[model samples]
Target: MLAATEKALEAEMNRLKLAVKTLQGEDKSEEIYIGSYLLARLEELGVTSMFGVPGDFNLGFLDLVEDHPTIDWVGNCNELNASYAADGYARVKQGSVGVLLTTFGVGELSAMNGMAGAFSEMVPMVHIAGVPSLRQQATKPMLHHTLGDGRFDAYIKAAEQFTYSQAILTNTVSAGAEIDRVLSDCVIKGRPVYITLPTDLAYAKISSDRLKIPLPRHPSPNNADVESFVIDEIVKQIAEADGDVVVIADACAIRHDAIDELKDLLYKTGYPVYCAPMGKSAIDETYERYGGIYVGSISRPEIKEKVESAKLILSIGSLKSDFNSGNFTYSIPTTRTIELHSHWTNIKYAEFPNIGMKQLLPKLTARLEGGKAKALQLEVPRFDAHVPQETDDIISQAWFWPRMSKFFEPKDVVIAETGTSSFGILDVPLPKDSVFLSQILWGSIGWTVGSTLGAALAAKDCNLNRTILFVGDGSLQLTVQELSTMLRKGLKPIIFVLNNSGYTIERFLHGKERKYNDIVNWKWTGLLEVLGDLDGTLSKSYTVNNKSELTELLENPKFAAAEVLQLVEVMMPKHDAPRALQVQAELSGKTNQYAL
Candidate 1:
């Protein structure tokens, strides 16, 4: 207890010391360049690489990035892919915001789709754009990248709808402070922001004194009386229940950096913990008390029944999007749920405002440890389910997913596209410390390819085992060029191409046999040879049309433990879909959510 208190005191003292230094404007130094300052801040936040493409407007800033000591510039094929890569990096790195750079109007506009997804999913990032000089803005000159209408503020206006904060560095005097403000908000809100840096201002000198200031990393919640009463009432609520208590971990656990706190709470209370699809990797999946994932109609039978029939449900960081909640299919009423969020929490429809989960959860968890509970002893259901045989030449969905479960190792990062791959992974149990990456709420198909680039880099920095990606053939065709960039950086993520030959997810959504769902065939197994390096060295690629072939490859020691890039094209029937996907489609179709 003394050691823990001393650690807390030390952290508080360091925070105070930094705050005091910022207040005094300690010994202004002329040693900082604007671009250098940006890169330095990122490096301090544990960011090893910045993702973007080099354009003429942003080339000056790239020069500073190139000369930086620790930060590397990861140039992508285009702006949109760069944005996707940054989003993935932020997701895997945990507590660090993604950084993306682009040129003025054309580049920023093209990358808007990626930022929109970030906004919808609450991913943190800083999107910087290199615009024309301040002189050109004053003269209203028609720039090459602009619409020739001389409206300089047009793009930033569009960006405002998609970002939490937006700023244009028109003066060097305020550039440092403005940058700090925007970055502070990005980290605090866990949302993307937009900053337009002028071409000429990229080289301006700035004071580095502000670097001494530290952002408030932890929340200092208010309403002490409300907090005390709430926790007591929460305990009472649980004790009042007759049957069992459960915790539903959601995506914001990852967004708000509450994984440890949530885990501590569950462990202390000894309650069964189930994860939403968006929160798949947030909790310790290997935990003995872990129930499978729950998402309304699509959830596994055991999970759905356990969660819905529980005496009380405690949902932490809940976000129920169309895809996440199985199109509003959750059976638990608000009266039965105790929903805790970062800022506010509610119990049985009673609101407690001005309380932060980052600060409140630990108290609640500790309070439950020694306190008596009605349902102190509970048992989670054990499933001895069998994996069915394929009984055919092609690898079926059931056979492929469960087979890959044993292949996963600890500390690995797995990314699945927003199609059959994501739905198929719901049943497989991941290895300990493995991170799951997906954009389900946004439902972007090809986001995984670019995100894999960023995720692989992050995994390498943390010395994780592997960065694996599961993408369908149709989705891969959208942004497959990122594979070349991955090769350029020498990142070796295990790529699994679910080669069903068309938009299988879309077919389930609206078009079962529509011509719009079909795509042109590509030689998936020969991609490495086409995108070889200057030395003509190629990564390994394999095509598997039979179960035995895939079994042999997965069982091979050298293939399972890979050092370079490897791609496996797994063939299955075009109409094959995961059970979850089929259930979700039936629900949506019955409600006319998708076209007839």
Candidate 2:
């Protein structure tokens, strides 16, 4: 009996000693720091760079990111720009989630608008915020970044409205699981997620077992019977129409990582495929059957006619926002439409839940008879820049967009800002494999400048062609400070600042010449030097006031090569706007019941 008691006591002592060692973080064989684990998971997900502004709460966590071997920390000028940059990165780097790091309270709150835009547009993003320690929260001490009213949950509550999933890491045991769950939601749903990493938990030790296991990247598999029924119904619809079907691809098709499947479907079916404005580069434009953009009433005459007259419409991953659909002017009835979504399918009036397109598309493609669509006699309008013959020096909106379109190259990433830039680029066709990004649904004015930085970085990662940005002078002023961040990172992007004096889109909407539409003018070309290119070695700037000067610059081989950061201040009439914008603004004005 005495010997057995002694043995039991020794076993208890050993257990206590091991517990103490874990508490002191000395046992390193099976455990890893939470911060390092998070970074590892991100690296596995193809996050080569993270965008954010550093702060006191996140400083320690930033230290881990700095020590990381692969992931580079890209410090933005502010949190909002950081969020926008992440959005741009996600758009260019399909199948990869953009990671954003920010501090608690003020920092995270500032990034809310950008993340909200991502949620609205279905971009996959992970927003990681470093907050105060758990002990500090328990004591309820008033911190500098907090609201000072001691309502610690207020900020996170605001995030819930915009984020698809959220988590606060208070316990070390469940931190890894929580992270995996939230990030999985972001990827599967293609929306932003919020995570709060308390300062104390940054170094908390957790089991490293989960690191070896891969996170679930794909959505839950659909029910087999339901999926088959959905596909059968779709095929029946197409057969009933005698394959007089037209396919319209939209933003979610790209966001949900269905581009390859979509391409296979389009190629096999040989149907005339068109894209919405947000889905500009969803299909390879070089294909013979690839039609131009279809923006409802604003669509080019030939495209609008071909699409609306179809006996059946296969709308893939469509998000018919106001601007995308020309102010809700889509004339196609639901009975004539078959919609494929990430999580569900709608065949005419019948809705089938739990049937995701990712799983159903491949099966559907296999079942369809190839090249049946070739029998349909249709003439897809030839989409070209079509620069008009001009007699004068001024570069009108109509002249500039088509002229600029000629400068794009295959594999380029083009980012157009809201207002004139977004609407103008719609009429021009990009090169094969090019990527186009715009905030048509969100309509944030100054988004392109910051997004350009992220897109250029992503383009470099993907080994794509040049990154181009178009923004008006008025919109540029809001987020122009991000230019310095771009210069600091040595990113090479072609930035075209449309030097139209004020808010041209706003002027067209409610105030033709009102003071609210006016803004302070700055020397646009001198911005490169002011932003940090002191000796002009890192960047080149130009001001083109006439058609010939701009034409010469566009034709220059060196300029087209994108060897260095370049900015062109293309002067235009302040009152001028794209035809699409004029029509959209008028529609918007009437909808708002505003007197112009």
Candidate 3:
């Protein structure tokens, strides 16, 4: 006991000396709490807002977030919605990572689905879970949030399947390094990462010296010889193609931060550019070289013919999920395709690992600039907003999508739910600088409502234009509670809820008249009044049943530019679906093979 007491006293003396050195500015590493250090890193990454729910384990951390100078704690309706919101925020605010806070066990489990969806869609996010203290964990006592079996790692183990990296911060000594590693992985891999912050460690003082340097966003440089060889091979292929090559951009082209590099290739080479369903808005669709969306068999005949006939297809960041590629119907053989990914490249049958598009695109563009790949003047199908001629006043899917496209202005952020909206809006061309957000690969229904909240907040921070969301009534029921949180935060977004009678997409896929595909019909316009808009001062709701009413509403400047939140209930036939969806559903049905 005497020796232990003496050792404790010596440790105290050492701490005091370090504190004095810090105060005197002699020590370069300033001391800061672990939570503060983490928040500082997030702020450096331009995280203006974080989404989460308040729980006992995370309340102390929330105090730090509440007191933060720039980071706002966006209290959400639930953990799942918060996770979805974070995904949307990251999608809108490029070059920044989305931050999510949740309590251990139940809270983190609730957010698991959203995190998995973000991982599937390649959205960069950091999910910080506040767990029990070190002392508590050491005692192995039965905790409220944990199972009675004392299996504390169960949740994190479950999260391992979804996240790119995981960090369990046990001590202040390693807290900064752990945080940096997880955050760097989150951004570099463009996927969600899990970090467990114990309550005790949240305030533990750690040296902040590492915070002086920013985290590395890009991966390490490729081998000089290998990179040069790869670039030369790509240039040779393009030059030999004699302008028979085409460029197809997909979802990862945007998520991996290769848009600028991709645009350079498209412009300099003058190659006809097409995007997959998931890659909408990755490049400027208004450009003359831009063709329409390519979804394999589901694509329009003209687009399919144009893309399939190319001798060589340069596929950038291609994620050929079933829906994105029309149920794996891509006819382009591996021998005729060159694929560029975030961390590797594949030329025909040969794979060149570690040669990423972000670094290689510039070299390829430079080589192709001076007549290496002769610029061709090929005819691109004009993708303009043209409302179909309909005799009836009732709004149909074909008419609604094109008409809505006309209402979109430059720099608008458009989010679509997975059902009708995602397929419906795919045919329409958005204005330049417009952002398109959708969970195409994941296809999570009702994600748009929570995403709109996050996207709107991000839009506010980035000083972008209006945020518009299109969601089906059936899908909205799952996440409608998030609208209250949006109103509380004073975010103005125009939400168009298609009030069809039932699950239209499911009907098309299977069980066309099944009762399971039906949902409870809510009083569409009374939502705002019940959801904290008692005085009707903060919001407005409208129900448009016909083309004339929607046309007038879309044209009204006050309705379009409302300072308050707006919800438009668009009445449409229950059986109608977008043409793209009809084609996709048939392909998906054949793949499902329920009868077989």
Pull out the clashing pairs in model 1. Answer: none
Give model 3's clash tally.
0
TM-score result, candidate 2: 0.94
* Model 3 / residue 325 / CA error / Å: 0.4
C-alpha lDDT (0 to 100) for residue 578 of candidate 3 = 98
lDDT, ranked from best to worst: 3, 2, 1
Task: Mark the regions of model 1 whose C-alpha exceeds 4 Å error after superposition.
Answer: 1-31, 371-376, 383-385, 534-538, 593-596
What lDDT score goes with residue 411 in model 1?
A: 87
Error of 2 at 49 (Å): 0.8
Deviation from native of the Cα of residue 162 in model 3, angstroms: 1.0
**Candidate 1: Cα lDDT at 65:** 84
Assess candidate 3 and give its TM-score to the true structure.
0.95
Candidate 1 C-alpha lDDT tens digits along 255-350: 977787888888777888888889888876788778778899788787888899898999999889977888789999887899888778889879
TM-score, each model?
0.94, 0.94, 0.95
Select the stronger candidate by lDDT from 1 and 3.
Answer: 3
CA lDDT, every model vs. true structure: 0.83, 0.87, 0.88
